[model samples]
Target chain A: MRGSKAVVGVYSYLDDLLKGIADIRSADLDYKVYSPAYRHEIEEATLPGKSSVRRFTLTGGIIGCTFGWTLAILCSLDWPLRVSAKDIVSPPGFFVIGYECTILFGALATLGSLLLYCGLPNFLRKVGYDPRFSRDKFGLVVGCDGHNLEDVKGRLMKSGADEVNVTEGI
Target chain B: MSKQSEKKEVSYAMVNDLVLRMLEPPGAGWWVLLLTCITLLSWGAVSFAYQLWAGYGMAGNAHPIGWGTYITNFVFWVGIAHSGTLISAVLYLFRAKFRMPIYRLAEAMTVFAVMTAGLFPLIHVGRPWMALWLMPYPNERALWPNFRSPLLWDVFAVSTYFTVSAVFFFVGLVPDIAAARDRAKTFFRKMLYGVASLGWTGNNTQWKHFIAAYLLFAGLATPLVVSVHSVVSWDFAMSIVPGWHATIFPPYFVAGAIFSGVAMVMTLIIPLRKVFKLEPLIREEHFDAMSKLILLTSSIVAYAYITEFYVAWYSNNMFERFQFWFRPFGEFAVAFWGMAFCNCIAPLALWYGPLRRNIAFLFVLSIIINIGMWLERFNIIFTSLAREYIPAAWGSYNFSWVEIGITFGAFGWFGMWMTLFIKFFPAVAITEIKEILPPPVRNKESLQGHH
Candidate 1:
């Protein structure tokens, strides 16, 4: 967002994309990488930390579990209606409901965390996006000052960018 | 692995095209099939309306057989939903590569099948409008649903299963939907895919969270899948009725559910693959793997069948023994025998390696397995209730035309969702399929040049 111009590198091969990412990192340019599919090699190259989505899942599951048991136990005790001479508060039966809630809440939370972290429905800014990136291409987008834009473009091309485009204001 | 990719010769762009092409304007056949589904769904709707008007007696539920075809269909559809989760979530945890192409379809099946299954309990209750009372919300009467009852457990389990599976299905669809959005030419399609894809760009951050969350969904779903069917089984097993009360019912029902579900998957995929010309993606190897699964589950089901009979005899309980005896020898012997043939005997043909890979044989066998699974449920529900402890209390369920129409209509309901899904969304996972393909890489010379 600080830069007035950005350099975009379109890559057909993953190897070239990785090389470009390495170059941009060395040059200390803020950049983003895009791919047609998830790849471990890209993750290894980009070095984004482990996603925190798991924390959301764990927290959601625990809350769901607690809520499930409380609801079931409280509802059972409220009436104190005994059937089949079973216990007044049945953990065994309630466990089924609790287990299901754990999954339901866990999954919904994961989705919420994914959307929040990924900045989805991002209609505000779509700079440097290419349709081919969703099909077969890898894209490296580097934001830089207008004066340094040529240097960034040169570095990307040297690292093996198939095509490079420089646009004003990313 | 590189050599394998070289031999197969598929690329990322080709994968996108292959799957996205399925979302194109439908052909005559698709329209014809869609029309057929609507016609059948109308039949089911009219039947249900008549049942509502005429009273619960319009169907077969009478005397001891209070639960009839509606309950049977409920179990059947729920069982059918099991395979979707098994393939989509369980196989994913195993990192089974063969599931890459077919799991999307199976996951969709799981969602739609559960939607179809959720309707039955309402239909069975005779007062579909008052179904909300089953929920534990605070009421004016201050009456809470019985927490210990297996029926109450079912409301929680099945609803949770549907929610989780639908979320899993949609999460997997997001990236593929983005791919479709890129290829879409029409304005309405543009907005639809734009919103549905949630503006996915498959960037590093998006893929990072996406992969992490997807793994967690799979992990959570795997246990839930097993538990959901077990809860469904407990609705019968918790009852004191001789044949219904058994510890083995959980595993028995789970295996049978997967067996029938995988067959249902085959029943769907064979025709879909042919029509879409997805032979290279959904290869014989996938079907071979699916058939082996059917074989494994069929063996378990057959063993459970034997165990049911053995336990009945070994327990020295005459009621249990009589229920087991009457299943194959009494008035409903045809259903029991038919289930035995379809569930136990029919899948034995898959033992042959050649037949396991044969598409036509698998399709026919899948339909037979589905029918057999349905009959298996029918036998369990009808036979146990028909002759309980006292002979004087014995009864038979009368199958009315309404029941038959509604049963066929459930298929229409399921089929209608599937038909519309295939047209609007990417029925196959474009991104996952591309993930398995060789990454687009420059020649060795180019890599050395970069270094």
Candidate 2:
């Protein structure tokens, strides 16, 4: 819940959504912060950790393509093929298409992964989201209920959320 | 708020205002106009008129060689177009700082060069009216072009290249267009720039998409420089002519294309930088870098030359060997030496830093190099064919006034187009220059260290 609902929070103490609720006494009122396991996986993949598939997009793609393609064509030599009285692996014939396909696949994979990493489609994004988020608010979110909302408002004030507001309907 | 953001736009006609000072020649030399450009344009024009009336055969071309000066020029101009994409896309991908001014000029050169090139295929047509038949379709006329032909592949390659280069050129021009749109007093310029700008607001998201499209187009078009010329080379390689049938032709041609294209760029830019007072913008550093490239490609070009001769010698196929070696010593020797001197020898002046930085020396050298490169093409095509496999079939080409006229007029046409373009449009990309300049001296206090 700390990273969810279009909010990014960096907490000084353990007043963050998960920790605050876990430590809630009877006087603190009731609440829960969703922490699904897959959230951790996505959070780990994105933003935080060094371990990632993203780094392989360009370099790994090039290596896999060139050597992979060279092996494929070289192995095809044993499969006896003849077109117009020409031998299979005469060395000169293999260079042209071999070089062309290697570049083609490497370029294609790099292009695809670059798109995924950037999260870019539809070409435009919403800006100037909320005024309060710029001033003193470290994080602002929508949808905190009234009972827990009041108690949550107090916690937010204590934690310096700046200007907390009730967010019910769209 | 939207209305207020629009008001802060600044406009200035930077440095020289050549059009306003009409009497003076805007610092550009008279010799450039008289020689390379003007001569070429007018000769091509007169020849074109003769061509329209009498037909293409008047250009000294006969049954065995139906294509002549026009086809050669097409290859030359298309080769010239490569450097713009090379500088803009490849260097941009590599983040080379020297590309800034030259890149835009290269694109302009590309568009003009392609325009000049596309004319030849039409003019060379046996039936000019049937030119549209090359467009891909299975038509009711119950005819289709041979799909297997390299000529048709050229149709795809060139058209794709033109579209992509044109888009890349315009996408990069948006900021400059916005500036022009703001400053333009006339309705036509305002409207033209307005439409060209496409409401570019310089917001971060707009920049993201704009750059994405630009880089994408550049990447797509980059290999085409190699592909287009290689495919063109295949037209010769795919042939059964002894000297022409070598497997080495594609890479050889590609290397030659790059070599010549850089030579052409040097020829154009040396004069332009002088005339426009762009010494600061198109700096000595830029010259040094290109001179190195010119030298490098020249050596590659020279290397290709040696290999062609050596292979012809080593192959032990007597007809092939004689056809290759006899080129420099025989009838085409002048063209062969001219090619060698221009591409290989002339650029060697760049070995010294002083010569590399000297605009006048570089300018003269570039001209010589272009001549050599042009001769290189003439040598390759004519020499190989003039002495084909059988001696009985051997014949030589002598250019008639008609052929000479068309060649002259092609240059004239290119000059007229380039001359007009430079006259009206802001020749330099101003806004881009502003962006690249070391972050502006924010305030007086910030400038303290410089003093």
Model 1, position B223: C-alpha lDDT score:
94
Model 1 TM-score, 2 decimals: 0.98
How good is the docking of model 1, as DockQ?
0.72
**What's the true lDDT of residue A102 in model 2?**
38
Q: Candidate 1 regions off by >4 Å?
A: B1-7, B444-451
Model 2 alpha-carbon miss at residue A134, Å: 27
lDDT digits (tens) for residues B128-195 of candidate 2 = 67889986454686544433346765665676567667766766766565555545667777677667
* Maximum-lDDT candidate: 1
**Which tens-of-lDDT digit does each residue in B1-451 have in candidate 1?**
5536643688898888888889999999999999999999999999999999999899998988888999999999999999999999999999999899999999999999999999999999999999999999988997899989999999999999999999999999999999999999999999999999888999888898999999999999999778999999999999999899999999999999999999999999999999998887898889999999999999999999999999999999999999999999999999999999998888999899999999999999999999999999999999999999988999998899998999999999999999999999998888888877767788655444423
Candidate 2's TM-score: 0.69
Q: How many residue pairs clash in all the candidates, one count each?
A: 0, 12
Residue B293 lDDT in candidate 1: 97
